[model samples]
Target chain A: MMKYYYDLMSQPSRACYIFLKKNKIPFTPCPLRITKGEHRSEEYTKINPFQLVPAIEHNGFNLTESVAILRYLCREFPHVGEEWYPSDSKIQARIDEYMEWQHLNTRMQLAMYFQTKFIIPKMTGTEPDMKTVERSQDRMETILDQFEEIWLDNRPYVAGDKITVADIVAICELEQPSMAGYDVTEGRPKLAEYMKRVKKHLQPEYDEAFEQVYRVRGRFWGGENAPHSKL
Target chain B: MMKYYYDLMSQPSRACYIFLKKNKIPFTPCPLRITKGEHRSEEYTKINPFQLVPAIEHNGFNLTESVAILRYLCREFPHVGEEWYPSDSKIQARIDEYMEWQHLNTRMQLAMYFQTKFIIPKMTGTEPDMKTVERSQDRMETILDQFEEIWLDNRPYVAGDKITVADIVAICELEQPSMAGYDVTEGRPKLAEYMKRVKKHLQPEYDEAFEQVYRVRGRFWGGENAPHSKL
Candidate 1:
């Protein structure tokens, strides 16, 4: 049995969890309360020195890094093949390119925006800096333009027709911003349609996983619901 | 021949160049003068949207992101074999884990250090902030301690006894700070020995590739030599 440590609200952890469930892989879920700083504990550090969520421990082997864990899952489980991770070298390479590029591009832009604008400000009880938030939004806008022009260009997915792990990795980040009421695909028809397709592919599972994501939605929307640390 | 666009002084470019040469894979080196702003040209952006050096074009398929390019070449070439990228699933996963982890930890700390200390300050005509540089160094020190204690714990190579692409990627980044005269392995005997082994394995090929690396070494050491934009 493999021990998976993750939080439902964390994007990468959600991605890993969704992938495991989608593939029907048998594993024990070891949820970590990241907002509570449980991940920083010595017990969790032994599992992952970096103390980030979404680490895996199988027997004696321990692994961290979401992409690597997803890659490992795809290779380790026989059920997950072409559709989950295309066997074609060119397609795999395209997926690889997006995964690498996203770390600095989509992941940073979205995560930083949420952190600076929402998470940090809320946690610290400080006012959110609109200037900094706008800068983060501005950077995301540039990458979104590239995403439409280059990545999702007329294809059904980032790589090609079939949905690969790249789409899973990307959508997770792209949707994270929506938690703060910034629906990215709102203005662009092409991107809006693409988002629809992504949601359709992962549907019930996606909705189930991101339920906690939207729990934070009311925080920025100025509703009665107060944002929990996790929210 | 597959066209590999690179600048020798760039660490990622050097790693890709050396890997191609070592594997006896045929590739035409298409050098891009990054310091001259050639990479940002409209013509180059058509090939790589991010306007960065170390891109590749295989026939009509254009690719960016050095790690992805390396992964593609390893898959595309037969002569490279499992030793370059292990055949065992678990071993390959470990390498994948390292490659992914390095981007945020090892790569970020080192790159931020150089950018904040040398490149940005030089371009802006301002004194480098020792405070920020020390912060970057502090972060690197923590990771270096982890590198010795965790990754390189008595192992001959990063993953195990055999050298994988991860070593090439790491060694290239590890050597970059030397130009600015930060010998990371100075007091750490284990890491210093590990670096020696890495250099020895790569041998004459490593020395030849890093020729321009040492050429720029004089720049930060306060010698008479002027630092080129490429440096």
Candidate 2:
């Protein structure tokens, strides 16, 4: 059996969790409390020097990086269906394009949202810079616009009609801003509708896993930490 | 035949070039001069709105992002051999860990080198800030040290004894500092040896492609009438 080391609130961890559960892959969960700084402990650092979560240990081989783990899983369980990771050259390329592009665009943009919402408030003991937060929201909006126009177009999901890992990756990052109290769905109707479609496509097992994680977060924070609600 | 749009000086483009050549994959080379802002042109942006180079068009599929393209090629041409992309799950996961880790750690550090050695010099119209350059170099050294301690250890390459795309990705970024006139090989015998080994593995093709693009760069000026390097 494989062991998954992750924190539920982590965007990438959720993506990985959703991937594993959706694929019906079984693994022992080793949840870390990132907010409490458990990831920085010497014990955890030995597992991953980078100190980030969503790592895995299988048959004595330790691996980190959600994207890499996802790719590895795709190889291991090829029958999870082609939609998660399309075998078609063009579709794979599109997913790849998103994966690479999102590092700077989506990843960085979401960081701004996180910094403004959680990090700044927690660190400074003051309200976040609303101007910066607004700017980040605008930047996210621009990226989303591009996602809709270039990637989504008329398709029900990103990278064509099927729900690929690209959608999982994208939705997770988008969820960051939503968690930060911004209603990403309000202004972007197509994106909101697409999110609904993606949720519908998620397997019941995966959905249940996500719900379990969400309940834990909600109880911890005393608010609507549900996937769809603002964090 | 596939067509590759790239600027060899770019780190990611070099990764793609090295992989394509190493694997003996043939494609029409369409070079973009990043110094002249060719990548941002309307024509080029049509191909990749992100305005990054190393975009590829194969069998009517247009793809950008070096990592994605690398994976696609590995899959499409399985005969390229297992060393480049191992088939085993555990070994492959190790490779994934390095690939994902490099994006922020190694890649970001190397980009700082680029900023200090190239961008800053071009901007200030004088020698770059040596203090900043040294700091950036130190950052890169830290990453390289970790690369050896955590990832490389006693192994000949990143994944294992055999080199994979992870090595190619790692080395390409490391090469940027060297190309900009820093002797990265000094004081790090293991890294120096590894560089030699990587070069030796792909030298024939690497040198040939490098020479072709290296000479073309001499004709370039920063802007319409900006000063060019005399050498």
Candidate 3:
């Protein structure tokens, strides 16, 4: 049996988790308490030298990096539908385009948001630099604008009408800033509606997995839910 | 016939160019002169709204980003061998692992090197800041150390004994700092040897494509050859 090593709070981990559940790929969920620095332990290091969450081990093979893992899952479970990753040359290329672009754009922008809202404050015991945070927010907005004007552009989802791995990868990262209370959908009505549609398309099992993870963090729909957890 | 829009000096463009030549994928080369701002022009904007180079148009379908183009070529020209992108799930996963990790580690670090050596001097209208340049160099060293300690180890290439798309993508970016006279491989003999092996594995036609571009810049092998043409 394959094993999934993840921390539910992690954006990438959630994407992988949702993907696995959506496909019904059975695997042992080995949850890592990232807040406790378990990811840095020698045990985890033996699995992934990079010490990042969202890794997997299967049949004596270990792999790290969310995109890589997702690609592997798609290959292993082709029945997830060609829409998850189109076999057509042109559509697949579009999927690759989003995957490549998002690393520097969506992924980096979300990391910036996380560092400002979470990591920096945790490390220094001080509020994040507002100037830097605002800059990151602005950059993220620009990317979203591009996404709407180019990639989405009235389409049902990224890549095409049917959902694909590109949407799964992107929506998870886009939701990160929202979790930090940034509310990226503020000025972007099209993106807000798009998000609603995506959530609707996601399998119930996958949606439940996301809800289960978020409920533990005491957040609903990625924002303040009145009473915050003391833990 | 497909048309390729690229600027040879750009890292992603170089990767696409190498892949095309290596696999004998014929296409019309439409050079976008980045230094002259050709890529930002309205003509190029219509082709790729992001205005980035390495965009391609084949059979009326337009595509941007090198990774997308590489994968497209892999599908269109499957004769390039499964080794470039193995059919085996585990091997392909390993290739994907390096591709994702290198984005931040290798690509970002090299960008820092380019910024310190090229962009800073132009912006300040004086000699570059040695402190900033040294900092970038240190970061590159750290990244290279990880490349050796984790990714490379005793393997002949990044993905394994066979040179895959991962190695091609990585080496093109790694070669950028070398073009600026920073021989990153100087201290790491193993990396230097591996680079030599990769260069040898690249088809002569593809090697010539790079040779033609780098020779004009007079920075083919770093050091004395790396004289700034504009200077």
Highest lDDT: give the candidate number.
1
Tens-digit lDDT track of model 1 for B72-123: 8878885685778877888888888888888777777777787777777888
Give lDDT per model, in order: 0.82, 0.76, 0.79
Return the TM-score for each candidate structure: 0.93, 0.85, 0.91
- lDDT, candidate 3, B115-176, per-residue tens: 79766677688888899889988898899888877888879989888899988888888777
Candidate 3 segments exceeding 4 Å error: A206-231, B212-231
| Complex DockQ per candidate | 0.73, 0.57, 0.78
Name the runs in model 1 displaced over 4 angstroms.
A222-231, B222-231
DockQ of 3: 0.78
Give i-RMS (Å) per prediction: 1.0, 1.7, 1.2
Model 1 chain B: worst 10 consecutive residues (lDDT sum): B222-231
Question: For model 3, how big is the CA root-mean-square deviation?
Answer: 3.9
Order the numbered candidates by TM-score, best leading: 1, 3, 2
Top TM-score model:
1
DockQ of 1: 0.73
> Per-residue CA lDDT of candidate 1, range A120-210, in tens?
8888999888999999889888887778778987797998888888888888888887776677775666777777788788877887888
**What residue pairs clash in candidate 1, if any at all?**
none
Position B224, candidate 1: lDDT: 47
- Residue pairs in collision within model 3: none
